[model samples]
Target: MAITKEEVLHVARLARLELNDAEVERFQGQLSAILEAVGKVAELDLSDVPPTSHPLEVSNAWGEDVPHTSLTQDEAFANAPERDDDHFRVPPA
Candidate 1:
């Protein structure tokens, strides 16, 4: 699972990254560690475990769908500073 310096350089090249010798060496170690951790996880036995998108139970809480009377056009425009007939007037963008 260990990553090579050449592989790290190749990945950097594909990503259009310009890495110096120090950065390449550092990334090589970091990426190799990540691969080693994933390898350890792959060695685990979880036959009884079930696959799930979320760890906790999920449910949707919806409000009651009730009809209600809305405001009239004149009532809605009562506090407007400016009005263009039935629409509110605004400065040009």
Candidate 2:
């Protein structure tokens, strides 16, 4: 899992990044460490563990949907800067 300087340079080129020699060397070590850590994770024993979609239980907290009274058109449009017969108007973008 050791990342080489050439591989770092190639990755930077593919990503359209301009890195100096120091940055290339730095990223080489950092990327190599990340890959090594991931490799260690692959060595874990989880044969008996059941796969789960989520780590925690999930449920909706919303109340039941219900209809209610609403403001009239004039009341709703009272604060509008501009309006047509029954709708607000805005300039074209």
User: How much is the lDDT of residue 47 in candidate 1?
Assistant: 84
lDDT per residue for candidate 2 within 37-87, as digits (tens), equals 988966989788787767777766577789789999999899998989899
Count of clashing residue pairs in every prediction: 0, 0
Question: How far out, in Å, is residue 70 in model 2?
Answer: 28
Q: What are the RMSD figures for all models against the true structure?
A: 11.4, 9.5
What is candidate 1's lDDT per residue for 20-49, written digit by digit as tens? 999999999999999998889668797887
Off by over 4 Å in 2: 45-93
Which pairs in model 2 have colliding backbones?
none
TM-score (C-alpha, index-matched) for candidate 2:
0.47
